[model samples]
Target chain A: MKVHVIGIGLIGGSMVLDIKSLHPDATIYGIDTNESHLAEAITLGVIDKVGTFDDLAEADFVIVSVPVDVALTLMPKVLDAIGDNTIVFEVGSTKIPICEAVANHQRRRNFIATHPIAGTEFSGPSAAIKNLFQGKTNIICEVEKTTFKLQEKALDLFRSLGMRIRYMDPKSHDKHIAYVSHLSHISSFMLGKTVINKEKDEQDIFDMAGSGFESTVRLAKSSPAMWTPIFKQNKKQVVKSLEEYISNLTLFKELLANDDFDAIFNEMQSVNKIKEILNGMKK
Target chain B: MKVHVIGIGLIGGSMVLDIKSLHPDATIYGIDTNESHLAEAITLGVIDKVGTFDDLAEADFVIVSVPVDVALTLMPKVLDAIGDNTIVFEVGSTKIPICEAVANHQRRRNFIATHPIAGTEFSGPSAAIKNLFQGKTNIICEVEKTTFKLQEKALDLFRSLGMRIRYMDPKSHDKHIAYVSHLSHISSFMLGKTVINKEKDEQDIFDMAGSGFESTVRLAKSSPAMWTPIFKQNKKQVVKSLEEYISNLTLFKELLANDDFDAIFNEMQSVNKIKEILNGMKK
Candidate 1:
């Protein structure tokens, strides 16, 4: 099998690492506008060779794993470049924009929209690791738009990566992800910014941060190059989520300021239900 | 050596799990007001025997591991009851109030103000595990107030738990921790509350939450009984930290509303330094 992968960064590079194990005979072509990332992906043995969009026609599968904005622009072009039977898919965080971008394309039936809900805070080709997608949920949005043959093939590939597939409309996927994923990144970034802004003594932050702080602020270390586009692409849903998050924080602040320890304690207890919710998610 | 451990829950129980190896000959007595906890601790073999505050006089070491409010109320009493040369210490999240509460006590020299910067989201004796403090930081505040002999013994105990000790003024410890540890719990709780409030569909939250959301909101699963008193005791510093966090979120919200991608991107990149800060803390 010949596979063409766009944007040799975390998602794409990780896919290369895991998928190559399942298809050792597969020839993978790495494509990235960032020449350095393409080279690094090769050096990391995440892909077999360097190629371009021009090579899409000969590929059995084409995966776009670039920033959402770049994916939005590249989706239509990729569909135009790929052969009739070749399957194309993207693993972008925000699905709506990209799905809408290629909705009317003549070759739309060949393209699948996916959001693999797995990643570490780290980024780049060096950050890629095998089994990154194992036991993780993969949201496949607007699957009905894709041809049955390609959808089956994509599902097989996702299964091979040990990902459980969930189908949803692009709109629902974006909105729900705004709360569960995007909002989390925003909250962590803001927390890191708030603490960094207040505690100018870096050593103090270094010394005082415990496991809780480390876990809570871990997403703040994520690449801005990737998240900025995702936030922008899903701005409407993200903004709504942020407004609610800000309102909740304000209420919590008032509870603290009022010395209403009971309310604060109850509020925390109420949210403690997230443990069960997270457990369900893991399953 | 005879040791009396107050509040045989997560911290104290974990201490028993780890420190037992280093001081196998030590006669450890569990002291908790909660009857069930005392029974469970004894049943779990976390302590050799169950004791009470009255046992303080016989203890070569008195480790108070209760909520900060309880610790503050008990620190003076514990100090009064312990004999000279008995190294008394409490591992409360907040340090200033407990330190100040016993500052002028006749036995203050025997009490060491320490906050072991370690814990899981879970609570109780059932949640306790061995080596929870391995390679974690243990902040010892107001070291000058404790006698040098007690300080060395406390350090040795903390080191035996595989902790690195950092000394600071109680005021500094409380303030810095308000941003790093306490603020993280608040942010996580508020994040969980916000998502729970908005998503209304609990199933949606469970289905959509990824690893990032789980990590960012993990502290929301923490025990309210343990956290409430810490927040109440460190109210000033916590409120200050929460205000800053809320302000940062509000500002980020506005940036999203205004499509100020550059500002948001720059803010995230700046906070990205936390990766290095956290790495240093780990080492």
Candidate 2:
């Protein structure tokens, strides 16, 4: 098996590491815009060798793990460079933009749009770890657009990495992810901003922050370079989710202002069901 | 050592577990309006026996671990019933209300205002676990108001439990905790509410939610019984924090609506400093 990974970072680097372990005979090649990252990934033994677009012709699979914005301009060119037998799949947060980017390409059937719902706040090749997708949901969008043979090959590879596959249209994928992923990043970032701004006025405020605060703001540490484009591409849904989020906050604040402890308790009680949902997600 | 704990929930139960471990000679007594909770505490070995207010007169130490609203009414009574040498402390989230609740009590010198910033999302005796306070901050407020000898007993017990004590005035503690602890809960609860409300329309949306969403919304699983009174007691500061948080969210939304990805990127980048604050908290 010949595998080429582009924009080697946490997701891409992790994917290839699993491939190496699962397919011992596979030869892994990598390309990254950051020369240092490519070098670091090589030093870290994340990839077997460095490769360029010219190497795509001989690759069995090409994993595109660049930022959503970069994926927009790079997906078509990647499709142009791949051989007829090559399968190219891009893993990004938002789907419709990437799906539409190559909807008219000559080798459209060679591409698959997927978002394996997995990651940590950290990024870069050095941050990658193996088995990140194990038991994680991998939402494959526009699977019908990809040729059956290529889809089978990609699905088999993903399955080998222990990813649970779920099929959805690109539109639903983007909208649903806005609530689950994109909106959460915004909520976390803004929470961090609000507290950081207060930290300026109160130097020792963070000393009082506990595990609850840490968990609530953990995603604020996510990579802006990767997230900015996701928010831009999924702007409509992200905006809608934020509006609903802000509205809920405002209502909660109003209940607090009115000294309506009963309403406040009910509000929190209603959302406590998230515990079960999170338990399900954990499994 | 005779120790009586009022409200044998997560905080009180966990504290007694540590107290029992550290002071083998200590006899732990628990009182709760929920009779079943007191029974469960004994079954879980979180407390040695159930006691009433009458037992408070013979207690050497009294730990109040009820909601802030309830604490406002019960604190003075506990202070009244304690022996002259007894040290009584309350571990409620809001300090101002609890501190003022017994400002003029005859046994004010026997009371120490401390908010041990430790707990999990779960509540009740079943959620109690040992060493929950280890390496965690325990904020001591209005220490000057307590008698030196009585304060020593409580401080020594806290130190034995491995808590790092920080002294702050009641006013300062309430205001600072609002931004770090209280506001984060509102943000998390509202985040859960936004996603849960969306889940009604989009049944499978949660399947797309990953660890990031789970982390950001974890505090939503917190007991409303414990939190509603916290928001009620610390209303003013919590309201102020909510306004600032909402304002930041609104601004971030506008930035996204206007396609100002640069600003959005900068926003997250700036708040990325929370990584260090959280790292500091971990220490």
DockQ value for model 1: 0.85
TM-score for the B chain of model 2: 0.97
Writing each residue's lDDT as its tens digit, candidate 1 over A1-283 gives: 9988888877888887888898999999998887888888888898899988888899899989888888888889999999988999899899888888998999999999998989888888898889999998889988888899889998999999999888999899988899999999999999999888888988888877888999999999999999999999999999999888888888888888899999988999899898889888877
Candidate 1 residue-wise lDDT, B199-225, digit = tens: 898988876787899999999999999
Model 2 residue A251 lDDT?
A: 96
Please tell me how candidate 2 rates in CAPRI terms.
high
Residues B1-283, candidate 2: write the lDDT tens digits: 8989899888999999999988888999999999899889999999999888888888998989998889999998887788888899999898888877798888888899898989889999999999999998899999999998888888889998999999999898989899899999999999999988887843375578889998999999999988998898889999999999999999999999999989888998999988888787776
Model 1 chain A poorest 10 in a row by lDDT: A9-18
Clashing pairs in 1: none
